[model samples]
Target: MSRQTNKLTATAVKSAKPTDKPVKMADGGGLYLEVRASGGKYWRMKYRFAGKEKLLAIGTYPEISLADARKAREKAKERLSEGVDPSMAKQLERKLGQQVAANTFQLVAQEWLERVHQHDVVPDHYQRNRRRLERDAFPVLGKRPLSEISAAELLACLRRIEDRGHVETAHRVKALCGQVFRYGISTGRAERDPTPDLRGALRPHRSQHFAALTEPSAVAELLRAIDGYGGQPVTIAALQIAPMVFTRPGELRQARWSDIDLDNALWSFTASKTDQPLLVPLPSQAVAILRDLYGLTGRSEYVFPGARSHKRPMSNVAIKAALDRMGFKGQMTAHGFRAMARTILAERLGYPPEYIEQQLAHAVRDSNGRAYNRTQFLEQRREMLQRWADYLDELRQAHPSSSQSSAQ
Candidate 1:
């Protein structure tokens, strides 16, 4: 005979007091409420799976209620009919959920940053990437599983940045997220990278060229202005040497005295962006300036040590502020010295393009597709820099009004 079901009532369940022993009220189809002597009530469903008897804990009293317990019993019956074990299925679902929680986007991204990204870039570059992710990407997507993050969801995150009128920042954050997703794929935390699907999703941003001066006459005027800068002796020397060597401002300010061979007229160091060795052929003028500055700051590690402490490099804005004070605020900038050299060397002085680019520490390659070694064209570059420095001296000696008037 079949077992009787629906033997419990809500009125009886609420009023039924706990006794010295536990009591169970049957609600049919193997569902029942067990009231313990401790006054705790729980719902359980008894069943037989694969010829073995088992019990499934549905929930607790008042919380599960009589109606909810009956519904759970029907669902468990459906699972049995399909040859699925309800208890085992529930356990598997819970384990999968735990795995998802463990492999969240933020956790995987952090691993990528520490193990991979940090080694590939400079510390400052790595820190900037980390800050971009933390400030924009983390709060919204951090807790979500890497594999579960869809391309549409990623686009939504980037759209927020674009909505704030930071189109360029949005583009950068998108690329940053792409790196994280690719890392996640390699680590098996993600199935695929979704960024490729977002090619046209972001607003295109125009590249903002750094303010630079390319005209020789204008550059001459700026050079003359630099000559008149009444800054500290250390800063004056940097400004003077800046045009002669034309290195990136960061590399110039952070230059270590040990990296230069003043005797050989060469400055050799690893390029920050490419992490490749670069050899800068210092002209006699550049070497002379360094020698004079050495008397004041030669003992310090950084050639242009900060004003407050000799331990740190000068502030990045120090040269910019100096230029502003010299009344070349919009007309020229510290980095303009490089553009000035590149243009004048190729056009005015008639130096080869490859030599100019190589001197710029760019990744210029040979005819056979090999990157030029740091020492490539050493002799030619040495001559070019000397002539370039001498030409600058001529320009500086020429009246500032003379070049501007000649341009007219």
Candidate 2:
């Protein structure tokens, strides 16, 4: 628009009428009220950048009044003087506004949960982290802006978890918070990961070893008790095979029909902790227990299908509940079976440590940093496991109250 063209007024902008072609009501200085052919009114600014003409939207009319449009136009002129494109400036401003809108700790944390936590970790690990965040972190810092969350505030949040004697959980949650904040920084939502500032702030967590029976006599008692356990057949079968295979309770409970090769007397599964394939050389006693169970659950996907839902595996809680009923709550956990087998395999059976580790399916890596093969000690493990089962039978027979029940 030239100086000679009359400036548009608020009344002219309000009553602007549409026509077959769009009309521009000049407000001078390259600003105009655009009346489109479809009866839409817009505020458009015409400018030149890098020798090309461009249109920038200041805002729609009625929301951006005449005074506001003039101010916006003045701001655009200043940017032009600075050799910056006004249109590019508007786009950047919108992007920054969106960044500001989504920089809240809760939103960023939720994003981290989906993109990093759940994607990288196992499902059970993700669930535990999710629950901790909901119960501990979300209540304190969820809605706050990531920029405003200080180290002190987060330490206070973690200290609350420690006060409740959840020392390890507190440490874990702190590590998770660090992961979330670092993700926010990487994604341009936060400035810093405040967790590093909290170094040595939380108390160290002491790990308690799982209580297990390493003594031959104690093992005899546990085996005898399993024989007399008045529980479901599935439960009884699981108890019977535990001493022979000594698999992690979760892995044993989640065993599937396809994972078992009864003809070859081998039970295969992927280890949950290390995410590696495992092959447990089933002894004759263990194979007998599984063969008996096949008559009950061979049609289902899970060898030990849930009582309530055959589609799913048996509940870990139910297995633990059975342990509680057998007077082994704190004295012995289901995981204790692994420790018992690990000790006796090395101490009594005199198996090589490498062979024992292989049978335990530990995450042992070779010199090339490749994981040891799943069947590395297959033959040795097959021999060792059978001897362990026979030794357990001998211990049961040596006991004072040996019922001499069949391996059926």
Candidate 3:
């Protein structure tokens, strides 16, 4: 027996009045429009699977036009002909869609950042990494499934960043993507990291070390210039203290009042890079500068609070700008103080490298190759810093021409 199909036209379906009960208008091949008494029109299909009749709801009228409804009906029939149940197939497609949506690259990267990355780095580092991903990677590959992103596609994203002449940033973005991909693999959201396949794809970029003055004469001149700077009072104080401590600029700016004990001349805080507790034995010179600056910023949390707000730390570039003002822009940098101290301490003052490195909070390994503990050379480092401060005092007080020969 052959059942008639296409018995309803578009006009007939639209003009068909709803009765007191629901009515079905057949279009063709198990497709029909259900006109409910409540004025709702919906498209449905009636089909047989394993000898049992079932229904599939396509969509509503107008939203699902007649041509679109016919196409959907044909696709559903194709699934049925392939020995698959169309209703179950539709449900499976929907579930897969939901799964893909849940496993998007952006979502996985965010989970990685919050659960693992944030806790591993300082807040500013975490924030900068997040911003890098947002600006560079997220807009392109964010919505795609992490496991499905090919190596070439990811490289294309990096290439766009490279094309902008930000070769270093492009490399950094690539590394960040690699981290997210590795995280995805560990969390079962991705099958593998594609970044390994991208080796040698990026343009070669020469690494540039931070500008530093290792010469004792230049360091002496730099110290003299820092003392004479006429900036904000807090900035002047920071400049005075910078060479004495020579901790990373971020660490110095973020120094808290509670971390210092003027009586003992020690500052103790966790190192941002190594995440280890560091003990800085402040010289009498550094302690004096702190004591004088305390009256102005003693109540604030940060030793070097921001200019506009006491709640936040000072701008990271404050010292760099001060150096530029002092005519030492290319000659020396704020970080140059570390190289200056390390060089003179070992080459001039004849201090052991171990003591100077330990004072610098660097990871100096023992004979067995294990990292030495924080307190390993405490007493020697204390003496070394005091002497280092005295040496700086000598340099600052020396006549300009005599500064070069004043080193011990």
Model 2, 1-408: lDDT tens per residue?
446433888888899899999998989888999889998888888888889998889888788887789888889989999999998888998997787668888888888898777866545567889999989999999988887899999999999999999999999999989988898889877889999999999999999787777777777777888899998888888888887888878888888899899999998888777778888999999888889899999999988888888888777777667778988787677788889999888877788888887777788877688888888889989999999999888888674544332211
lDDT of 3 at 24: 89
Query: Residue pairs in steric clash, candidate 3?
Result: none
lDDT of each: 0.88, 0.84, 0.88
Name model 2 segments beyond 4 Å from true: 1-29, 35-40, 50-53, 62-68, 92-126, 129-165, 174-199, 365-371, 400-408
Model 3 Cα lDDT, one tens digit per residue, 20-98:
9999888878899999998889999999999999999899987987788888888988988899988899899999999
Cα lDDT tens digits, model 1, 1-408, are 998888888898888789899998788888888999999999998999999999999899899888888888988999999999988887898899988887999988898899999988755678889999998999989999999999999999999999999999899988988999888888778889999999998989998766778776777877877777789988888899998988888889989999999999889988877778888999998988889888999999999999999998998889988988988788677887888899888877899999998888888999999999988998999999999999888877777668754433
Cα-lDDT of candidate 3: 0.88
Better of 2 and 3 by TM-score: 3
Residue 25: error of model 1 in Å? 8.0
Please report how far candidate 3 places residue 67 from its true position, in Å: 2.6
| Model 2: ten consecutive residues of lowest lDDT | 399-408
**lDDT of model number 2:** 0.84
What are the TM-scores, per candidate, against the unseen true structure? 0.81, 0.76, 0.93
Error of 3 at 317 (Å): 1.1
